[model samples]
Target: MRLWLNRIGDISLREQLITQIIVGILCHELTPGQRLPSTRDLSRRFGIHANTASAAYRQLESEGWVELRHGSGVFVRTSRPNAPLSPEMAVDQMLGDIATKARKLGVSDAFLKARMRRWLALEPPARWLVIEPDPELLRIVICEMEQAVTLPVVGCGFEECSTSVMLEGSMPATLPSKVLAVRKLLPTGTELVTLQVHPVAPELQAYLQRYMPEHSTDLLGIASRWGDFQRIAQTMLIAAGFAPESLLVRDATKPGWKRGLDTTTAVLCDAAIQHDLPAGTRAIVFRLFDEASIKDLRSHEENLTTPDRN
Candidate 1:
């Protein structure tokens, strides 16, 4: 039986092995009484430590998916197990397969981890843990989510969510672009939610209609510490027929990024860095969550908070 191992991501190497073995049994890829590769062989084949391979086999045996025969090797259980495998078992199998393929294609461990994290985080979060690489962007997401949902919301950098205190029974959330990186740090079974930003065209058009005249040459400024946010904002503005040259983009994480914005017609920024804009600057603040995102958040929150009647 082929066992796919993912070296990076929030799921540990041992958990990945155990999950894959169980999946193999459930799918009949590993049949009853089928002997599995020895611990040393498994370690050599998968580039893992011998102890990790041994621990994986032991876990499978403990979980009743396999049996260990002294002086022999591990074998798939011949009899039916007491409990049925969950749908998530199939998901685990798919993840393993993807990891294996990704490794073969010369993908970087960091890139694979990011991809896995994003896919894993597609599940809705219980409570919101806003993930942003930038401190300013993190605070903005938390604030926006708080206003949109009744559930508790907090903010942190991508690295901060790895702590046990931050992850326990909490849902980690972030902008769509950062989902992969944040997901890589979360433990298995942790739910991740992606917050969608409202498209800028409709809102920007409305603002222009209300504040500026036809064919006006007013410069529009977009500011954010997050590169994704800046890019998305720029794309939306250009797509809405705003000339690229008329838009001033600023990366607030860099020093002296605040200068020259006062000359623009209006500065558009994420809520977090709005305070840092030049005094008396006319600001069009963009929100992180759209109406659909709010609805999804409400549904997830309700599912978590509402007890099962059954």
Candidate 2:
């Protein structure tokens, strides 16, 4: 990830660097375990003083957004606290407080240590549980997730998210719109990954501009297993000035859905149902997950599959 520094802006260079790097990590542009540029390199590239760059990196490390190892340089941290804490001093304080509390509660130090180790050794996520209210949308998201990551993908509605069977050994993920609600339903300490939806309007607009000139009445077909997907595409095309009568919509869940598609100019469909389109039909697939979201899922999958030697 490239950092853009505003040398002339009201914010100090150190503050600008810190803010941009934090934004990159939060947006998944700079992923967990990814190495950050050295302070020297950042200084040279941005024409900032070495101390300014170093201060920004030190602040990031202190805030737990990154880890600065002695020889390994700085890496983006995997865990984020619900509240900010100084990485070294605050962590030491936290552990000491825990020990003090345990002693006051009549807990043995050895037993406390053993329980802490067990919590640290708890199993990583074994699969993904996609939480969405719409069954059809859930299925589409699961299909996209399965293709993007190695982990097994399953799904349930928001109400079912609280069920033990649905969440056990599974990482809970949901669309951005449902993130807050899903977070409330998950167990405490369970992190919810927000799935980013792909924006379809730009692609659709570009295609129309390139192929279908304005006022040209070519039959455009939209096919998808999800009825909402078909309806959305139909609406977008119509909103772009394509007459409603010039569009053919097909729901792949129904019979004879592909029969009339081959005769149309082109078919726009969801990625899950694109293969089911008629053999001769020209297909444009609208994917559910954006590339960055897919990359984040794959990163989580990698952590699950790769064992920790330490």
Candidate 3:
């Protein structure tokens, strides 16, 4: 498995590895009995100390997530049938689970109690609150959601999500990349929807196959108000064998950002701002979400509005 580790981040390397492994297990990406990368391999590949990798694997084993075979490598713990639970045992187990989740979210006992009480009194979600770090990406997500579902869709940046009032009566949604970070800031028992991002690499490759021969020397433009999108597009193009000099990147956030984009053969942009490009400029629109995610959002809206007859 490929793991991305930041050596300079505030979180320790061992802890990061543990969290990522656990997340993979929970997401079903690491299935039961799957062998994990060896400590020596992790150390050599990631440039971390061997001791650090061993410590992380040890912690995971202690937490019941993996098992260390004496000679074989560590593997995910297989599932086992649970013993029958009495009524009182079941209740206690449920409460314990709640406490554990709350602690992870940094909620004090008092705050948990207060929030639980308030949640019991509140009605169902009236809208979606999309949390994204980039304002341009936020607008794109909100626009797509607004089109897919009937409920109102609003958005705020990561900094703005700190205000608790914004979460009231709203279902929180974010990109898959931000789920872990956003979950930490949410209250216990809050359900978060991970918005799906469209897969663009294949489309990019096809574009290259179809157009590269004729447009080899043409100046192709990558336009987006979001810096990350532009950077990612440029990287993918370069990796696909496009010459860096033949690419023109325009950040829509700057003044007169569209002034020179009309000169390019075609401008690749996110769906939200495609119409804003120069009238005659050809646009290769890359939508951020696929149809399946939009269908899921629509189903969620239906469930929320329809009465639970049962």
Model 2 residue runs over 4 Å out of place are 1-113, 201-205
Number of the predicted model whose lDDT against the real structure is largest: 3
Over 113-164, each residue of candidate 3 has an lDDT whose tens digit, in order, gives: 8977896566789999999887888887887777788889999877777577
lDDT of 2 by residue, 139-217 (tens): 7888888788887899999788988888888888888778878888888767788887654534554676664444547
The residue-level lDDT of candidate 1 at 303 comes to 82
Looking at model 1, the pairs that clash are none
lDDT: the better of candidates 1 and 3: 3
Per-prediction TM-score to the true structure, in the order listed: 0.48, 0.63, 0.61
Q: Which residue runs of candidate 3 sit more than 4 Å off their true CA positions?
A: 1-122, 162-164, 201-203, 212-215
Arrange candidates, best lDDT first: 3, 2, 1
Better of 1 and 2 by lDDT: 2
Candidate 1: worst 10 consecutive residues by lDDT?
Answer: 2-11
Q: Relative to the unseen true structure, what is the C-alpha lDDT of residue 220 in candidate 3, on a scale of 0 to 100? A: 87
lDDT of each: 0.73, 0.77, 0.78
Model 3 TM-score, all chains together: 0.61
Lowest-sum lDDT 10-residue window in model 2: 2-11
